[model samples]
Target: MSSRRARFGVFGVVALLAWGAISVVRPIPERRAGEVISGVRTPAWQERVDSLQRGETVGGVLSRGGLTAQEATEAIGAAATLDPRRLPAGMRITLGGPEGAPPSRISFQLAIDRFLHLTRSDSGWVEHEEVLPWATDTLVVRGEIARTLYDAFDEGATELPPGARSELAWNVADIYEYRLDMSRDLQPGDTFRVLFERRRGPEGTVRIGRVLATNFASGTASIDAIRFESEDGRGRYYDTVGKSLRSAFLRAPLEFRRISSVFGMRRHPILGVWRAHRGTDYAATSGTPVRSVGDGVVVRAGRMSGYGNVVDVRHANGFVSRYGHLRAFAKGVRSGTRVAIGQTVGLVGMTGLATAPHLHFEVLVGGTQRDPRKALASTGGDPLPSADRPAFDRLRADYLALLQRVSTQIADSN
Candidate 1:
């Protein structure tokens, strides 16, 4: 019996040794499909990234990247969830495939920090949004407004950079647009200070982001705006006490090339007769989009004599606004249609009594037309909600410190 048990134990040890040798000798099987999808066993694919040229189409770009027409079509269709039609020129595009093989993965920027990723799958192709790496750097630009903001940057070494200078002006103007008329308010002696964070690409090719905090002193009137981003990533500018800086209405109905005429009496351009011009005239391209200045209900839409195509919106506190000289109304917009602030109502055109393409804007109180400039003198946006005070206070303290440091540097330099 002892001899028999010894023989059985030796046999078990030999079997275990044989099993270990076999495991070492045989190769493993190919990775499972789930492993590939989860990125555990990806192919040794090569990648190339490029920027889209002007007038480049997705299919055309893909075809140039070695994709067949059919492959391009399938990829585009699969990535259609990203609404690729809105992709602007200079967007980054990346293609991935095995070395010496056609690309099976395509990624393109739909926005600065957002990417649309498309990969070939057994069922066809799949697409999703992948956030690209984005970074922020705090930057400061401080100086007095001399002539114009752009000109202020045109000087010697002290001058602001072209794009950066204009960006600072636009952002600062946006903050003060409600309280100051940019056309008539800014002067040579006025000083300006801005501390903004520049959101940049991974390569740091670009500079400038949203305004973090700003201060501009024009005469005795001064304004302060601090940016606060909520937990969900929504950002807005507010005063120290937490009131929103955005006016209830946008200072301008639309971005205009120039203000052709101001409100009040003027020599009628067409008739050459002095008459009361109740609205401000903004000269812009014929196809420029015209936006409503505030949230309101469209009270009147369609034509009127001389005024031609027009839209009238009524807002809270007995305020009424008008947009005129539009080429045509936006689809589905009519009397009683609800519109939000900055909603496009129509396109700019020379539809009325004007000789050139322009928009005529007006504001009314209690049925009497008032200067649009006066109506925009006050920022009518609500204060920061009480619920947001705690979060806002913390952000405000941080920004104020940043602003103070930059301001001290500017003063010392001068």
Candidate 2:
């Protein structure tokens, strides 16, 4: 999240950034170019569902659902690997047969997308790990920004999982991080059309797949990004013509954190003076991962007056970025070490003159401090590799047509 000189504390900003490794681990499976898929699957074996009650054991659920006591015991034993003791109340359990019968299988969530599937084997009940079978579909949603992008999509968000909602915002912000300051640039009347892959299960659980393409428009600013991958399996967002949507630098080194302060004249938080604030402050919990916004070499990774622990990365085009008030530098990251864009360089902290944990981020162009927002955006990078162009161009045309249809639908509705 980016905003003009914010009054929110530093810790508020950095903790706001990342949703954790869970975001990547659960990402919707990537689709190759020209793949067209849109629909939900209805599995015939999804025959029953029951809720786990407080103080109810797996054996109890099994018995109540029609398994004989001995069968329940054997099934529970087989599911021991999942530690049934930790089963949360209200957990939904799906079965492969109707009530009053020994189901062919019992499935319970292990985590997002993962499940513990208990089945009857030749010898006895056995447990097997399973992941939900997803039916990927194209989801077209258009919303006028009321406050944040999340709020725009809040109408039907209750049906989606917690991670889905958080990831939707994260993905949207990530796609436009370089082009727009999410914390500040999103306007109330700005409208967005998101064309993405939506994965649904037989029981109706749903998650955001991959963001295939996005078109966002505000008063005067607009951005369009299409997801594309190369033969080597490296996927990134690119524009219609295949220009990389990624700039050489990231808008912020951290995830969803609000901008607590910006680069400009301001009242110093500690010094208590009307002075020039040379850096931006992102509030976050201590130890939130701080990243290098661009590929560069660490120029400094230590302390300075009022700056606390710091890591400065020097990039090409006479640009240098500083991350102060770090809890610690990332291992093996020090002066002269090469770093890549979005690589962890340090952790947020309050090691220097600060009241709370936060990352003090600054960007210097030609050795002069500039607004991190503008400085990061100026580094627009290159296009897709020449070899990937033909594939990307074909994909781009398809996506643009889909976006056009969505826009037309919106116009007709209005």
Q: TM-scores across all candidates?
A: 0.65, 0.67
Q: Note the Cα lDDT for every prediction shown.
A: 0.76, 0.76
Best by lDDT: 2
Per-residue lDDT tens digits of candidate 2, residues 1-414? 355335455656655654465466575588999986687654444456787999988778877777788887778888767777888998878767633446878888766678888887788877889775657666666678887666776642444577676677678788877777676567788888777766776677777778878888888767789998777787799876677877777777787643343333567778887877776777778888988888998989888988989888999767999999898999999899999988999988998888788888899988899988677774455967898888888998888778767332222111
Q: Name the 10 consecutive residues with the lowest summed lDDT in model 2.
A: 405-414
Clashes of each: 1, 17
Error of 2 at 195 (Å): 1.0
Residue pairs of candidate 1 with colliding backbone atoms: 153-160
Give the lDDT of residue 136 in candidate 1: 60
Off by over 4 Å in 1: 1-135, 149-161, 173-188, 200-204, 256-266, 274-276, 385-391, 406-414
